[model samples]
Target: MHKSDYIVKYLANSTSDYVTSAQLGDFLSSSTRTVLRYIREIQAESNEHGFEIISNKGQGYRLIIRDKAAFQNYLSNSLAEHEKSDLNKLECQIARQLLLTDYIKLDDLAQQFNYSRSSISRITSAVASIFEGYNLELESKAHQGFSVQGSEINIRHCINNLIFNSFTMYQTARMLQVDDLDWNSFKKAATDIVKSRGLNFKQELLIQFMKYCYIAVNRIRNKRYVNFEQIKDLEFDIVSDESLTLMLELIQLICPEFEKTTESQWELYYLALAWEQSIYPVEKLHDPNPERIKFFLDIVEKAVENIKNYYGIDFTKDHQFLKDLAEHISICYWKYLLNVESENLYLDEVRSKYPTAYYYSVEIAACINESTKTKIPDDELSLITLHFAAKIERENRKQIKTIILCSTEFGITELLKSRLNKQYGDIDVIGICTCDNKVQLCHDNADFYISADQIEQSELNGKPILQLSPFLDEEDCHLLDEFIARLNTTVPLQSICEPNHFYILNKPAKKAHLLNYLCDYLLQEGRITEKEKADIFAREALVPTAIAPHVAMPHCIIQGSSFLVFAVLPKSIIWDQTRINLIILGCFHEGDNQIKNLLKQLYTVISNKQQVDKIIGCKSYDEFIKVMNDFVGEELC
Candidate 1:
């Protein structure tokens, strides 16, 4: 390992406030003169990179890189060339470990690798060389050992650089072997590089380069390559020649390092890129205006061409596909800007075929959203409404069916009704009664009443009523509109379980266990299967199945899963260290449009804590089921 790399590692591992030169010399097991020489070299490099290296004379050095863009530029320039091959290998090892973890200790690392402390110290010095320009200091204090001293941003950059360089080194390690290499030593070396340099900048650059390689290689790897013409209509800029050359060099260098596991590593890298892109789209260079869109499409087309030239992946030049991809990319861009979910069926499908392109597309979209002020379209608003409705319906089903008691006159009531209808057209209005005759018209049937005037009766005989007059003055309509505008608009397809099939579980014990038990029972009865279980598990992983404290509803959309199974756990059990006492397992077959309604009914029963408590106290399974069926109605299942 390079001496500079070793110094960097040692400093990063040491989290002390300061490390004296004497201590650093001791840590390196070298003379004070040799340690001073290494420090001077690091300082020189730091100066060249436009960052200051603080020397406390007796106390050791610190690096500080304040400007992120400048730091990134410094990192890019630093890693642009691989000067010392052996140092690079050590650097790669250190980088990989840093990416995986936050910090490392020098002594622990030395012991793990069966190396002398001095050897680890040497590696740390070498790693520190890469972080020269970032105004960072490597400090070591009694008990603390060594650490990097600089701006948090600079420290992050150093870590990223270490990882990027380490990745490069890992790929090229086998070709150039230095004896006495171990995982601990390698990891320590990498960690040092990250501490001295920066990890975030390096990682971003590496990702960019890897994406370039992935696109190029995939095109040629497969038999059916996408034709450039097919993707010509899509827009995105091809990376510059200089950038491509750098990527090519990196690939060639690293290819030999992981020769045996090249394919797997490549696959993993691609998967990571795909996942990240699906979640967060790339930031585009230009805004999402018409001209900018055209420019983006051109860039994409150019990228597609480059992919064809480098790799043999066949890209369709279909205008519609490109257009759609661009639109999806745009959506992804906005989603990232809005901090929302971007990857769905569209991006997922694209990833299956053109993973690289899909990532680029999403990233471009994200950039567009960030750069431009795109107005939310009517369709987007509608989509948001549906998403909002889904959440509302999920949280409070009683609110789904409301009675709007307004005066029969066309002034306020008609205006209010029109506004309500516009916002919640999907909401079921059982009856729209005039204010004067609201008491006479269907008292027992209404779910809730929204009225302008306050009723004197206590809860209207225990029925829930929302008095909007106090909250909704003239100015409140605008506020309400704004709130509604912010609502999620994605519409979910109607579900399959009927209202009668819905069952509520109110008990708090063994929530997940009881759900699983009921699912197992249903499976035994030929109501569900392994596939259904798998599907349910997948959804649960994305978001917790526990909708409320001490409660969980595990359900799946599967064929032959028709009945809603309700299981009550009388005593709570520790699930994932949380007390869960209630489990509601709703199983549904394909083509069940009433599933949404069932969910609504279940939501209503659970939302009422009093009702839930009463239900939980029931002794027999039959009695429990009876209460659920009574709430949901018996005929619909």
Candidate 2:
């Protein structure tokens, strides 16, 4: 894998986790300074997506991706733009050379590219600088040669940064280099570490091992040489202070078998460090309840199948490191589910043992069951209407002091004020005022103002202004109650006894036809006229009533209509290429107070999938009606 690819994978996996600089340095056998550089590059690349690589005083570095899709989109756009930049063209060639080779020597790269050693150094330095800024260190060990060190997360960040910043021509040309990176070598090393450590290994340790191998191989491919003094300074405490002597001994043992060059010495040191880091206590898998284990096993099997189907990446191969990872995860999951005592049950431990596996496991659990399931009340309309009245009344009560304004100075203002006070006795009118003059003192003291005429002169912005002209009639109060009901009430149950009642459809394929059919049904049933349907259509055009996926509830109140009507469509249909399967067509008659209760109940029933599916699956209309009656209850007519 390319250095950048390894970095991207690391950061993408370590959500809300910290990675220390020393840990990164040891993994890559590089200096902490170099790791810092890579982090800066990553931060710059992820800048637009709010990709922040935060560094705490004591902690090392972390990749915070607020918007995943936005970041990906930004990268795509950046890549397109980078292709046309001169700086990007040069960087591509540098990356290409680093990728294509097995072990790159700075001198060799300069010779091949016909650039001076100094020029090659500058290019490598520029690339290395990118890693440094992101808290990623690019270091070279005496035996390991060179490697990128830092937070694995930041390393992943560097890859994305590089990919997005690099030229398109370089991307296509770099394919050969990508192939030569020997991703299998790192995978093998990771698998071996897991096997040697047993199921007890922390997921983070496995991740660290994989990252180490990835960086080592890339360094060799890049032919980026690290000086011996730099390798000696690496702070690796995995091997005790005395064990450092053992590492030297091990390196000596391995070095003679290879070409014994300076590069070979470095490679041996890297191998020795890998061996030391691989040592850990093996965890024995506890025999969990067979039934519980099987349940988790089935889930894992299905997940594996889905992964194969969706991504086409087979994990069944012998060399597949993630295969063992999957097995370990299943064991942990079984232990967690059955409440069995196990050493590897904690999420942190699971993360350390199988980072990727832990992530997928959580996703599976979330998909199986949501965190919350709140059911709305059955008498939705009445409940909602009550809730609306309570809310509005509460707000109105909060407006204690008010000034009544009138354009025509008659007893009309006092008469309306008396009625308002009778209904809402808490309201205190400071005095009667006129819109013809500015009353600054009253404006400051009063919470709201009652007016009869249009008053454009107002210094107060959010202060309540009640217009009495529009609200004088009894019909207007009913309208206010209905509007309040819609806001306050939960969705109501469909009144199955009402022939012209509306039902919300949940299926996507049948939504459009259902809507059209309901429109025609209302007209034919004499519940609505063509002109009213046209009016409803115009309202729908202004603001669609389709609230959720596969469901649309359309309604409009017209004058002189007596009873409400409903039409139900269960199957989904396409509307503007968007499938809406469920629809509830409600036609409310003038002065109908029960519409709120009906709507509330319908919303409650529709919200419950079990209830909705049961209603939709009925073989006969009577069976469907029976299910509706049972759900809404026979007590509610």
RMSD of 1: 19.8
For residue 20, give model 1's deviation from the true position in Å.
35
The sequence of per-residue lDDT tens digits that candidate 1 reaches over residues 63-147 is 5655557656755654444366455566546533432333467786577656678887887665554333333555555665555
Q: Model 2 scores what on Cα lDDT? A: 0.47
* TM-score for candidate 1, residues paired by index: 0.37
Compare the candidates by TM-score and give the number of the best one.
Answer: 1
